[model samples]
Each structure stands twice: as structure tokens, then as C-alpha cells.
Target: MAASSIANPRSDTANQVWTDLSPLLQFNNMEIINVADGVTSFLIHPEITTTVGRLKHCTFMAVLWEIWCSRNRARFQGQDMSAKHIINRSMLSIRAITIAANFQKILQPWLVALCQSNSRNEILKVLIPKVVRWLTPPPGRLKMNVDGAFNMTSGEAGGGGILRDHKGNMCCAFAKPYHGLNSSLSTEALALRDDLSICCSKGVYEVLLETDSLNLLHIATR
Candidate 1:
């Protein structure tokens, strides 16, 4: 009934979608008469801290998003996507989220079993987080680390950098705003150049530069 109200013109389609997806959810034998019933069940049924509950929440959220996307495509793009395609998309979306959140240990088995019959044998890749630490420069040297970013929509760019000594004490820092910058690499180079100018002004000649951008590093080396 709730699905019918929201998607009035496509109530029949919405009900069919709900009917197909209902078996996957654990509603504790309570009849889900409407969308509100399904939502209330999800909210109260699971203690989200638990692994099983988290998986269920993620699956439901992804499925809802896929459903909304399907609706929008049908209404605006004049496209009719199959329920199977929506279901598969939802699975892939949740699978990606689970792997990214490192829920492989807890939810991977469940996902594998649920999607075992999927035609495409998509591998759920687990992300291994790397430990990153800053190393101090040599005794007589100063280190400068710089970074830059740009917004594609507004065409705005900014760069910032910090200068640190051998003992890792902050010597100076600079942040600058720019306009009409085309790429992030150019911004990074500009930030590096600005920081280098600051070093020159302070007469700190012995310097080691560090940047996370490999392309900028290549440019600097050349």
C-alpha cells in the first residue's frame, strides 16, 4: 500500500518488485502490508551494531537506491529496466560497499552465498588499508610537503603546504587560492613552487620536498 501510494502510476510494478525482494528480507513472519511496514521492520528488527544487522541494512539501502534509480530512468529517460537488472545492480552496489568497508570477514560469506547463482562471477575485492607516516628530514635539512585540489564545477583551485624541520617542528605554512587552473598537477606544481619561494625568502637552502602526487614528482624531477 505504501509503495502504491508513492509510485501510484506504477503501483502494480512496485508491488511486483516488493514481492520479488521480500523473500530476501527477514521480517520475522510479520506481513509487510506496505512500504511503511517494511521500513519499520528494518528500523526495529536489527541492532545495527551486529554484523548480520549491518549487512541487512546495507542490502536494503542499496536495493532502495536501485529502485529509485529505476523509477527515475523510467520516468525521465524513457527507459524500462528489468527487475532482474535492478536486483543485480543492488547486489553489485552492496558488494562494493561491503568490500570497501572491510566487512569481508563478516559479510563476505553471506554475500557469496546469496549471489552464488549470479551469472557474472564478480570477485569481491577487499581493500587493505595502508599505514602512512611522515618521516623527518636529515639533521641539517628541512622538509616541505605540499598538496593541491580543484573543483570541477566552479573551476576553483587551491593549494597548501607546510614546512617542517629535521625535528618535525613546523617552520612555516602557506595556503593560496587560484582561478582558471585546469588540472590538479598544475596546482600541485604551483604549491610546490610557492613553498620553495618561501624557503628561499627564509634562506633555508637545504631542503627535501615531499608530495603525494606522483605526476608532480615526475614534473619536478624533469
Candidate 2:
């Protein structure tokens, strides 16, 4: 409940914040609990005083603070911030704190490297790559992109596909919700089958099928 006070009045805000931060600040299964529970557990553990543990603990606090501040800014000043922006700001703040206190001993090698970079432009250049344009299908051929997602906790899977012409105009799109999927491979296979069936039904003989699953690709080609 580290930032519970800030989110008490807005349940939706709390959900959004959690959704954005969960992937960035994952904890071990035993350490996964309410924010207050996790914080208390960390405090009680002797290892929490170690250099690495202390750095991680401080990082968690900084990220929580950044999330609260970003929420307030969005609510009052009409300025919204992305999760990436919050993380970047938190890192910079931690770097500043480490510098002021001369806490280099506790800093990780990666953190030391980040601090040494100093230049925002250099960091950006290293972190963000140039965008590339999507390739268009050859003339007379339709392009189909299919993907699938599996939720381990829910034991459910979903798949979707989109078909576009050579000019990149969308011709058709489809999505399906599946339950009790054994694995991601099954979901992906189902998606490919459905997408290809749709194209066949539409009289599309020539197609450029694209999928991220190497297994599926190999299966189809073979």
C-alpha cells in the first residue's frame, strides 16, 4: 500500500497505474503480495540491508513515488505521462541521489554505466532505434498477419488476424476467444488455420502470410 493514499479516491487510476508498473517491477512468487505486505517483508529480511537489496528497495520506492506524481499531474495539469517516461524519470532521480550521497559502492555495474553516460542524447540513441516502415505485399497477393496471446492465470487464449491488400488496405479482420488452451502453440495453430480459411473463402489464392511464431512458420512451410 505504498501509494494507496494517492489512489484511494480513484479505483480506475489505481488499476491503470498497476497495469503500467507490474511488468517493470516484478517480484518473486514468494514476494508477490499487497504493496504493504511486500514492503514489510523486505524490511524484516536481513538480506534487505545488502547493497543489491537496498538498491532494489530504493528503486521500488522511487517508482511508486513517480507513479503517484504522474497521476497527480495528469489529474490537475492535464499532462499525462507514459510508464516509460516514469521509469526514465525514476532512474534519473536515483542516479542524482547516488551522486549526491556518493553511494557508488551500492550501485550495480549497469547503474554505474548509466550514470557515466550522463548525456541524454546518448542514452536515447542507445535505447530507441529508428522506426522502419512496414513492407507491402507484392501486387496481386494478399498479406495476412496473425497473432495469439495466452493468459496463464486465466487458462484462456485469444487469437486475431488481419488481411490486407498489396496496397496495405485492410480487407478483413477477425478475432476469437478460446478457453482451456493447453499451450501457446495450440492457440497460434488455431489462428493460422482460421486466417488461412478466411482467405480461401474470400477467393484469395495468393497470400503472404506473416507470423511471429517460428514453429508455426516451419510447420506451415513443411
| Global lDDT of each candidate | 0.70, 0.67
lDDT of 1 by residue, 40-143 (tens): 65657887887777877777666667777888888876878567777777776665665556553454456553453222345435332344579999897889
**Candidate 2's residue-wise lDDT over 1-222, tens digit each?**
344343222445444544454443344322344655654554455355565556556666776688788877787768766666776776776666555554545433545433444433344333332333578898988899999988675587999999998899999999999887888888999999999899989988788989989988898889
Per-model TM-score versus the true fold: 0.46, 0.48
Model 1: pairs clashing at backbone N, Cα or C within 3 Å: none
- RMSD in Å for candidate 1, one decimal? 9.0
Off by over 4 Å in 1: 1-124
Clashes (N, CA, C under 3 Å) per candidate = 0, 1
- Model 1 scores a C-alpha lDDT of 0.70
Model 1 quality (TM-score)? 0.46
